[model samples]
Target chain A: MNNSKQGMTLIVKTVTRVTVWLIVLYGIYLILHGHLTPGGGFGGGVILALAFLNIMLAYGREATQKWLNLKFLEDIEAVSATLFLFMGLLGIALGGRFLINFLPKGSPHALLSAGNIPILNILIGVKVAMSLFLVVWVLAGLHEEKGGQS
Target chain B: MILPYYIAIPLLSAFLISLIAGKKDEWAVLLSTTAGASMLILSIYSLIAQNGETFVYKMGFWSLPIGIVLVQDGLTCLMLVLVSLISFTSLIYSVQYIRHMDRNWKYYALFMLLITGMNGVIITGDLFNLFVFMEIALFSAFALVAYGGHAEEYEAAFKYAVMGALSSALVLIGIAILYSATSTLTLAKIAEKVPTLDPGLIFWTGGLFLAGLGLKAAIMPFHAWLPDAHSSAPAPISSMLSGVLIKVLGIYTIIRLYFNVFNAPDFYMQVFLVLGAVSIILGGLLSIVQWDMKRLLAYSSISQVGYILVGLGIGTRLGILGAVFHLFSHAIFKSLLFYNAGAVEMALGTRDMRKMGSLARVLPITSATSLVGTLAISGIPPFNGFISKLIIIIALIKAGAPVYAILAVIGSILTLGAMMKMQRYGFRGETEIKKISEKIGWRMNTAMILLAVLCLLTGLMLLPGIRESIVDPVVKVLVDHSQYMQLVLGR
Candidate 1:
């Protein structure tokens, strides 16, 4: 877990880094396949969490916080919620129904199969990612506060 | 057509509140209050004239069997009114309740978000939409509960968040299973296709769905998070949480699934009847021993919800009628009680009954209003609770469930006992100001009094004509669950 290990320990660290990258990539792969396959925003988001977790575990909370500022994550979460709401509202304006699939229904088994489904997946991924990310950070911060209290 | 706005106003307000978080505190209050008030008015208007017209807004104008939709019917109208009314009252109460809190913008922002979620759940026609709205509402609620960040509050919020996350995950999995089976997401479409589903899928998914929604509803086994979250939140939020959140999230969702989607099967009713009975008796028994005032009210909500579930579960016209009536009555009076609790907590600086006495002398409006609310909820004669309780008991006997009737009567007495205890310890006894907490503003007093007046008057809505005009449509929606599809998507 330290930064200065060498030889076999360095090999172990390299393997861990590669494994974390694989997990993160796999999550995105699942998310992209959401509309046509069984995976979705939730699955992809969890995978992303694993990737982030690896980063934190490898470096430390401070390194992670530097790149993932709490304010930015909070904004992303809010914006994602707003985006989903707007997407639902857009269907209303389009004259079909609330949340109707107005986009071209790509071939059922194709990559872009369900109109809005892909959009929904992307939004869900971002929303879930930001939500989970911020929630984790907030929880960690709370722990620090609690530790201080005692 | 107008179904979307049930969620829109609160959501828009939340966005606006956040955008203007630091600019002007007064503007944030005005904006959220206006959003809440507008929703309140719209819901009441919908309640009165919402019959015979089913509004369906298909997402993106997509054809049937494929698109997500928002369905607004009589039942939706009832819940919409209940949610907005309670939300409005709570927002009003919070204007003064949360003055001491530093982050006013974040508080109102979350409040708006919670309202949006609750409102959306009542109106959405898509199963997936239901889950989405459920997450939005519960997530914001978790944040609000932790707003105070006191050790106890944080502990409760964390517990609540963990349990809430589990339920949401279950619900998402259930929706995925449902989607896999039906290949469609609209609620009416699901209702149409669900009956023909394979029995294994029906049983398993149904159980999953039930467990998921049941946890949200806090019925018996899934109720572990209720006491802590309910007791630890700010008083206005405590009012909203106990008064309306559980009903919208748990009871309403369960009823919608049972009646519209699942056809009110015997097993579901049986489950509801038993849960209702147990919650009523158990919650009542637990409340009697609680010395903390808001905690007592929190427990009382579980018992009250039991009454609603039992009434709705009876499946008779009288049963449905009694259930919806009790729902409206509870939303009003319970909120009134919370406002009273908030007022006392403000003036007396304590939620423990042992620390308060003869409070009526100093806080006349709060005491008088609380007295009215206590009488109403305890089923005293001429109050709203009595009428609904009577309807439920009569319906129970008519449905050949005589034992439940007896138990309900006993529950009523227990409720009466608890309220009497609140009355004696909280207001009627010698005024004991062991410690001064803080000064309460006029805005707080006005909100409590307004709700108390409504409690006293809403009972008159039980008159036959008023019942015919107001309650019948909502009852009919529950009774005629199978026709919801036809109504929403005309044949």
Candidate 2:
């Protein structure tokens, strides 16, 4: 089960350690700038998941599991989803429409201009990122249950 | 005003359970049940309060041309109420049933997702939206069917998923074609532009839709997946799959598109009639030979669905009346019977009829409730099925198709014989039963009892005054689908 936490060779591990943060930064940019650009929550989230997945490849699943539990990912994933729904419900609770842009429209093509959209995008990005990571982690068979049925 | 809550509460609670219902199964049970209960109330209230009024909710404050829409008509409202009521009962039943699998939270989460998908399908006002919601429903259904983690369950779920994917692809192609023809995704907008388009476009798109959606409904020809998929799922899920899933995905969408979107083309109506007759006989005959209790019920579901199709095929108001009413009655009674089947399987640890006998003495609640379901399904004199079937037969004769009327009668006889087979060998046989576990919990019995009582009570929906208030608007909405286009667009 690779309990000693060994991963790839020195070159690959060094490359991943160096490049992973840039990918994370790029994913965050996509999520935050989703309202102004094409890369919204979904695209950005995939990139983030890929970054973590790269870390898993370089550092080994056992090391990743030590730092990042799937249970935490599941909880955060669900929290992000619930937060997204609450934002929609927030629209309804305000006595306006169900999912109206109730916030102030700052301006066009700006970072904070699209009232509720950027926030919703951020929530979706968080959810997508965590959900994707959890799926890949489980499918990778790193979290095998004890004597579980197939 | 409350239209959004139909989808909102379930979607919210599904995630909330995963977030907050941590570790303890009881918390998951409590949270989801509250969500399901509120949903049921909202649906029933919608049926009464909407009162033949149509409501539309636009997402994100965008107009209909640009934003997605959620529409609540009489038909949609009726289905919303039906789906919610059935799901609520099933959730109650699953509280104990899922404990055996040791994964209550996951099951409840998936179940809530299922309800969300169904509610979304019933409420959405766009073609692409239906496809998206349909996928949501099917995905969860696939997972739930395989929740038992057994080899057979996985095989059945895989088969169902493949068929589901194929049907969805056809539906997507039709939607893409429609978008190309009309350059819009809203159903009413497509209807507005359909008459101005070329006839060949309509023909191809309509054919694709029928083939795709027909597979979902398990009509006579495309019903290869129903028996396995419906029979293999856990009991409550089986009830939901057999009871509401087929109707909403298959029959409901077909009715929506064929009648409202396409303007009830005479050609499709004839096709529905012939196919409906064929399904009745085919499903009936096949059901008689099965010994697996759920499998027999599953086959019988295809036949029961056939009755709804035949009713709709008649195209008269009386025919539509019977069709819609049959849909309601069939949903209740069929789910009731599935619950009984599930209860038997739970208690006996087997689904084979040969191994079960004299269960009426042991599982008395299930036996009693199953009697109501059987009579209601078999179209006995006093139950809801008899009234709906009689209405359909009378409409068939009035439509100058006496041959179809006789075929309906024969289908009835076949249904009776098939159900009788189950009753005789399954619960009333000479094989003495022993060693029943305390598997049937109060919640399970409560769910069965609720649906069984409704099986008999739903016949009152046939009474003249109540019919006008409850059933007539749904028929009017379906029969005159052009009115649907006008109403949605006009609003």
- Candidate with top lDDT is 2
lDDT string, candidate 2, B1-491, tens digits? 78888888988888888877767688888888999899889888888877787777887668889998889989998898899889999999998888866675888889999999998998999999999999999999999999988789989999999999999999999999999889999999988887898888888898999899989999999999999999999999999999999999999998888888888777788889888999999999999999999999999998888889988888899999999989988999999999999999989889999888998778999999988888999999799999999999999999999998999999999999999999999889897786697658899999999998898898998788877777888999987778888988874
Candidate 1 residues B1-491, lDDT tens each? 56677777788778767655674478789999999989988888977886546777665666567666777777788788778878887888788778766556778989988998988888888788888888989999998888777888989999999999998888788889988988888888888887798877766777887788888877777888898898889988988888888888888888888888878878778888998999899989888888889888888888898999899889999999899889889988988898888788778767889878987667788889999999999998787888889999999999999999999999998998988899999888776554446666777877788888887778888777777767777778889888887777777
Q: What is the DockQ of candidate 2?
A: 0.65
Judged by DockQ, which candidate is best? 2
TM-score for predicted model 1 compared with the true structure: 0.84
Q: Residue A32 in candidate 2 has what lDDT?
A: 96
In candidate 2, stretches whose alpha carbon ends up further than 4 angstroms from where it belongs are: A1-5, A142-150
C-alpha-based local distance difference test score of model 1: 0.81
Interface RMSD of each: 3.8, 2.3
- Each prediction's whole-model lDDT (CA): 0.81, 0.89
**RMSD in Å for all candidates:** 4.7, 1.9
